[model samples]
Target chain A: MKHLTTKDLMTAGIFSALYFLAIGLVTFICMFTLPVLGNFLLPAVAALTTGSIYFLLLKQVPKFGAITIFSLVMGTFLLLSGHFPLAIIANLGFSGLADWFTYRTTFQTKHKSLLGYILFSYGLTGPLLPLWFMKQQYIDNLTSRGKTATYISGMFQYVTPTFFILLMFFILIGAILGGIYGQKLVAKHFGQTSSKQISDLYD
Target chain B: MINIQIKCLLLFITHIFLFIPFHPVQQTVLVGLLLSILFLEKERKRSLLYGSIYLVLLGILIALPYFKSFLGHSFGQLAMVFLLLYPCFLAGSLLIRTSLLSDWILLLKKCRLPMYLILPITVMFRFIPHFKEDFKHTFRLQKMRVPHSSLFKRLERTLIVLLHAAIQSSQELTMAALAKGINQLETRPVSKLTSLTFLDYLVATSSLGLIVWRSFL
Candidate 1:
């Protein structure tokens, strides 16, 4: 339990894939189905759906570096799949912070883990940051890809400061809701409500 | 068939190419070139599917104004991004569909990543297909039990079962890998027994050539 065992890494990988699929499904559906609300709904929906998977991973591994490894794989996948490279940086920052936060509680308390999930959920905003922060590059990219000026303008129509603030708010609400649901799911299904239960099963 | 390294190289090049401000015609050519490579590799079905999707999206973009009143411009914007990302999507599909765990392990080992990182990544890739199947099975089972349930309820139950199955299988998979001495200190480095074929060489050269050409454009 001190270091990441091969088994721990393997479990992390398996769950990372699951987590990615959950997030990917939500994002893809939102992006295509509700073009207008897609950007705003994506992070919130992703955070909402992925909480159970994330909680399960924590319950299984419950060690340092588990969250880090999970997020690293996700960030790398996003980058390879054409997300802005800053996605990786944001992922590392948030996941590291989440890992540290969980470690501070020694993975014992539920409150700290919920806080960690809230922080980790902010990482979802990384991919969309380029829309606001690097507006020119984003425009140039669309224009280069042969988008019409109308299309580009339409894309930016929702990228206002208000929307950005709203996006963060959605992320926070989603994280809180998802974290509570996730805790309930873990406590019900795994029967391990406390760190002592997790340690006894794994360590 | 192309090796994992070549597939990864193409994927990497495609990612970079996505951001490059190439002329519209040149960008289309690059996508066609990559599709041709997929065709060469005998993935004609997927290549054609991707090719048709690209054309359909392009058609939609061209006819943007007609749909604008109802669908709004966001539809066109999404179509544009998808159109541009078509080739990248194709390259990624090829990589994911074709690669094996041994190939990834060999490649990651060549890059000298630690065992922990390598093991997880490999397992992730390996588990994806299995998880998909498990998800389908669980969804069907949940639907049978609660035939009148709401979609959200069915999905939630399915996911719960899916996660439980995944955690259970992870324990089994770890034991299987460990029994095979995956974590042994004295294990030999994975050797490449298959040499690069002529097609592999041609694909590599043409992919690199496309990247270089796109960069200058």
Candidate 2:
């Protein structure tokens, strides 16, 4: 319900651009690395961490404009970085949903609990669901190609499970880190300075 | 003056041509011709320079996959990279040149999309460029202050500034939208909206025709 000042609007714009640049950089790095770990790590962990940092800063800045900024930058970055068009669309859609959810959770609850909002934001990573599905399809395609048993067995043993596990790990890690950062931000900005507040940061 | 209809149709034809699986040489030639037509309209010298620069960049971009193969990469890997990157770049360029954000918004409105959804999208489009500029300015300021930070630190600082900005702006944007009478519940008749021109029809028809031809012929 709070109106953003001119300064706040300016800040939102800046963050959005940074968000785009960061995503592009991370994705570019992953492309060069082309490692299974790099693929999941860069897109999931890097992106979510950046989002969390945005939320943490937003607590003090108190601007909803950041949501739009994040969405635009991420969408543009994905588009320009040669990701699938659907991925770009998903990024925008999910970011918007995450923004709305964060806003509702913070304002409606009247507590501005960072943990709640962080969890809400993390849930919006549902866009990555398609990646997992795609991986399964790739495995199936390989199997259908009559690839050697050793290759199939090696992929099933190493590639498939490693990807899913890494993805899940990064998602959870990103969420937990974001939640912690959010709590720290709330405590610092909202002046809930207590030992309990510090301890409750992860909650 | 080029008829807007013709221009729109040309745009559609170009898009369709770009997507077809033409031979590599044919694709390059088509791309060159299209780029020339698109960029070399008014100032011959400037367009020539632009076209040359574009070709150089595009050559590098396209050759990157093959370059990797030359450096001991497999054909399949190189082909995969090309497949993933080329369409995305083409699609992005097309979207930037041909698609208007406002037009998309109008279409959404016509489809009776909820304001909550439409408003955020509109605001985001409006905000992204502004945010990018602001972040650059902030980064400059931060650089002036630190002047010697590591690259990682500099990046962190930049991100921090951006996050701060986003939190500060949304409320003002939302209020500005509300002030413009955007949130009103009154519904207007969709039939009263502006009609599509002949160009729109021509472009639509040609695009569909090209798509069918490319897909089935």
Candidate 3:
């Protein structure tokens, strides 16, 4: 296994911030759009933004544990926020698994890398899974607040495991599309020149 | 204002207990923290105003569904989670804003963590400002497109260029830090300002007691 250089570590840190910025932007935009559709739309949009930026970032620094470290940091921040933090473990698990596949290619091939990214993106949806598992708590909170059964039912549609799984599937599809699109963006604009630049970044 | 170490401990236990159905204790901690923050009044005016707006919104959410059955379902559900998360979010913001990255680095070092782990985290803190500045240029790069290129091509090129500049800046930063001996753990001064006080112990004891009381399930 090739050890990551100091430069690799630094670049990974920068990309971590970059990924968060993109995700935060998407969250704000989706949050402000409309209520129900916004909640449904958030995952798909987040998958695209984070996935593409992550691919571009991975291209810049092709190392083994980059995904692991980045996901861990993001997860830590999530945990600190007192939200559904178990997703951090989910992220670490999936990203570590993806890193295994990427190591098979030694972070060389784009298709294999994209495959890893798609698997890795599943972790982003992990935080939202509480809506399914914590259904009773969520419903109780709403019901206590005088939310009607019909209103609760509307909310329930979005919280169902079936619906959550569907959203995850949609996110998976977006990540796949975004990964392919990111590669194309690279090939079209920067191409071989950036590969040399990427190598230079390692120094 | 709490010290960093206790704040960390408070954050940890609070985060853990917050999820495990400790309504009475949780609400007290959350409301206390929220009010203290609001009273501090740095962003107090906004907090006050937003507080009213949020309450009104919550009321609207609870009431709106009774009248318009079709519209309230998903929105009410979403609002419930939002309200539940709001206080915790405020507490988190307070902890994060109060705690510096260097403070975390020192705490990690005191815990006998490695240089490799510490370096990346510190550099992550360092990079936030640069990323914020460069993020603005991404839009500018989009507007300053190639004359003959189509819109899609210009957009693609902008992403490539923006990332290129970012990666380059990171490389430069690493080199600068490296030259300054950032890789040497001995060189960076870890603050000895903190020792676990009574509050830290109290926080730990409370969390452990709570966990045991809940039967550790």
Candidate 4:
């Protein structure tokens, strides 16, 4: 296994910091400038930024530590901030999964394709944890107000379908954008470096 | 510096608290107080401008209804709306004030998360300002060309520029990462450096305490 240098750690740290800043900026914009739309797009923005940075960082550092560090910090912030605790955990878990799927395999072949990066990076949104938490809260609100079980069930029946469809739409959008970005990056700078080329450098 | 972790906690608690059935007058006052705090603490001039605009719009929304029904229960509903809006503004201000982006990555490292997850998010975070800057630059360029376009045309053009910028920047950003050798799995000894500070603990405790007190105490 290749060992990461101090440079790699610093790179990851910088990337992670940038990631948080982007989310904060968008969240603020959405909250103040576009409340209704902001509610929908904030998560989408978060996902897009996360995917982009992850791909970028992974291509540069190719180390688990950087990715790990980024996710842990983000997850902890989410947990402490009292945002959707379950969703934050899921986000962190998915980050690890996405990294493992893309990088671990690429290491063997020594060729990190844009497709693999997009697929893995974009897959992190599959949990849609935030939406799930929001839906659950809505349900809780309805049920606690003395609504009948039937009413709550009916509400979910109507809401869940729409929510799932939206989630799928956002996920696809994130994947396509992530792919485009990854491909452009590969073509632009690392055209000669394949997973195989990387192996040679390390070997 | 305001720790990102504490800011996040404050935002979280604020959102949850807003849902409670507070009286409309109290809610409006709370919203005012929150907005005032944000206006005072926010650093970015542009964000402050946008926030003030939003607050004004919200004020108009609340007042318009009141003017029509000067003494009816609409005042109460308006107050409720204000209450709901208050936290969102506070959240926005907090986002601008705290250095969440870098700190978040550090915090993630301590937790032993994987690279795949971190990479995408990091990229996305970088994209925001780039998007903003690009959008503004393009908008200015377009305005020079069509200085008198109708509002609709101007808005349409702005959207187009934003989309194009997002696509282009994402590509550039990804390539930059690749050039830096970001996509491989290397083992680095996880730093023993703790991301948490005393402020983080204080914020967490206070936020949780506030929520508990509000909900049941």
Each prediction's TM-score against the native? 0.88, 0.58, 0.81, 0.50
Give the per-residue lDDT of model 4 (tens digit) for B149-216: 88546644664444334334444444565676655423533343446666557556755655565556
For residue B41, what is the lDDT in candidate 3?
36
Deviation (Å) of B109 in candidate 4: 14
TM-score of chain B of each: 0.88, 0.62, 0.68, 0.61
* lDDT per residue (tens digit) for residues B3-41 in model 2: 333333444454344334433333344345434543533
User: Which of 2 and 4 is ahead in DockQ?
Assistant: 2
Best by DockQ: 1
Of 2 and 4, the candidate ranking higher by TM-score: 2
Instruction: Give the residue spans of candidate 1 off by over 4 A.
Output: A28-36, A80-86, A105-108, A142-155, A193-203, B65-71
* Order of candidate numbers by DockQ, starting with the best: 1, 3, 2, 4
TM-score pick, better of 1 and 2: 1
lDDT of 2 by residue, A1-203 (tens): 23644334434444455555555566677767764345446645564555445555455455454564445545544443334444555566655555665565646532343434444444334434444454454344344434456654443343355756766667667766655654554445435354234325422
Error of 2 at A118 (Å): 7.3
Model 1: per-residue Cα lDDT over A163-203, one tens digit each: 78988999999999999999898888777455354344544
Better of 3 and 4 by DockQ: 3
- Give the number of the best model, judged by lDDT: 1
**Candidate 1 lDDT, B1-217, residue by residue in tens:** 7877778787887777666666667667767877887787788998888889888987887776575453456666567656656667777777766666777678777768777677777777877778778877888888898899998898888888778777767777777878887775227656677678787788889878876777687
Residue B55 of model 1 has an lDDT of 87
DockQ of each: 0.49, 0.17, 0.49, 0.06
- CAPRI-style grade of the A/B interface in model 2: incorrect
Query: Any runs in candidate 2 off by more than 4 Å, and if so which?
Result: A1-22, A25-40, A51-132, A135-159, A189-203, B1-85, B97-101, B185-203, B214-217
